[model samples]
Target: MAAETAAPAESARTWLVGLVRRTAFAVRAALSRRDGRATAVTVAAAYLVAYHLGLGHLGLRAGAVVSRPRFDLVVVEDPVALATRRVAPFQYEPVALLSAGPVEYLFAPVNAVVGLALAGLVGVTLAVSVVAWRGPAACRIGAGAGAAAGLPGILSGVACCGPAFLAVIGVQASAGLLAAFRWFLPASVAGLLLTLLWVGSQVDPAAAR
Candidate 1:
């Protein structure tokens, strides 16, 4: 029985892997439209996405007095190292408590770059989210709904801030949360209101009212 079960499992694994490989190839062909620039299209698209996802940090960049990032994931226990009383309170720096680091996930350079493309995805979603907030009465609804569906970066930024430029997720998760639970129409309206306030706050504290 054990031998028979192992045989079937091996067959299943082989079949699944082959199926996935075939599907991936087929998808590439279809998306490339047979002209064969699917790889280039994918790369260009990825960069456009990363640029926008990198913008989520605009809020924090705009908000924070300190705009530097602690790359290397190296621990900094020295309070003096921070050098600012304005320790990005909103910035997540848990020297003692972090989930797992993503070392095993991207084992290859190709894998790392593909993962980097993910930052673009975060950017596009925020770009859409910001766009959604602007249009008409429906803009708010569209913005919140778009953001909720597309944003996995909302929470993942805690550990995923590796490619420093893609810092948008770390900053915008709160705004994303505010949009997600607030029901589209109402949330959109509220977000529109708050966004106006956020903009106004940038201009003048009294104007924020």
Candidate 2:
């Protein structure tokens, strides 16, 4: 009985390892194509913009009339250190402020860097999914898989500013609840990775090529 259970567990581990390897190969193959590259770039850029806007790092002024467009960038004296400080869950202190026309942005290096990394992951996952969708039967996967996987990532960005987000949603924030919000980004990242692996496992790299 012990050997039977152990054998099944070992087989499962072997299958999971194989799946991860296949997924890596599929992602590489997807990125090698022109359409996949274009899709990833476009999605990543859009996601980044949405993320910054959602975090209030970038926004438009309401009812503010500007006679002419203007631009300004103001940086703090100790920007590097400030950028490392967290203002909220997955959110960093703004080391600079930028104003262009009626738009304003708080430039947080860590936040921008992290957001970009997440956006890139989402973009790549979607790109691989698209490739699988368009590939032959052996490589095909459901087109919606990537989109569904990316939803949590988007939510994670919007939830990074916990208090503000909670207020918008009319949810009362408690000490415990606030602390739980901090895990959103990490959880979403893990979800994305798992979903990406699953999508990759479903695709045959040879067929994708």
The most accurate candidate by lDDT is: 2
Clashing pairs in 1: 49-120, 50-120, 52-123, 53-123, 57-168
Colliding pairs, model 2:
none
Clashes of each: 5, 0
Candidate 2's TM-score reads 0.76
Candidate 2 segments exceeding 4 Å error: 1-20, 61-67, 136-155, 158-162, 205-209
lDDT, model 1, position 48: 38
Tens-digit lDDT string for candidate 2 (1-209): 99999999999998787787777777777788777788799988998987887788888766545887878899999998898998777888999989888898999999888988988987887777666566533235555554554555455554565666678689988999888877877887887788787776666545544
Q: Give, for candidate 2, the lowest lDDT window spanning 10 residues.
A: 135-144
Best-fitting candidate, scored by TM-score: 2
TM-score (C-alpha, index-matched) for candidate 1? 0.29
lDDT (tens digit, per residue) of candidate 1 on 68-138: 43222334475344433222222222222111222111122222343355444333334433433343122
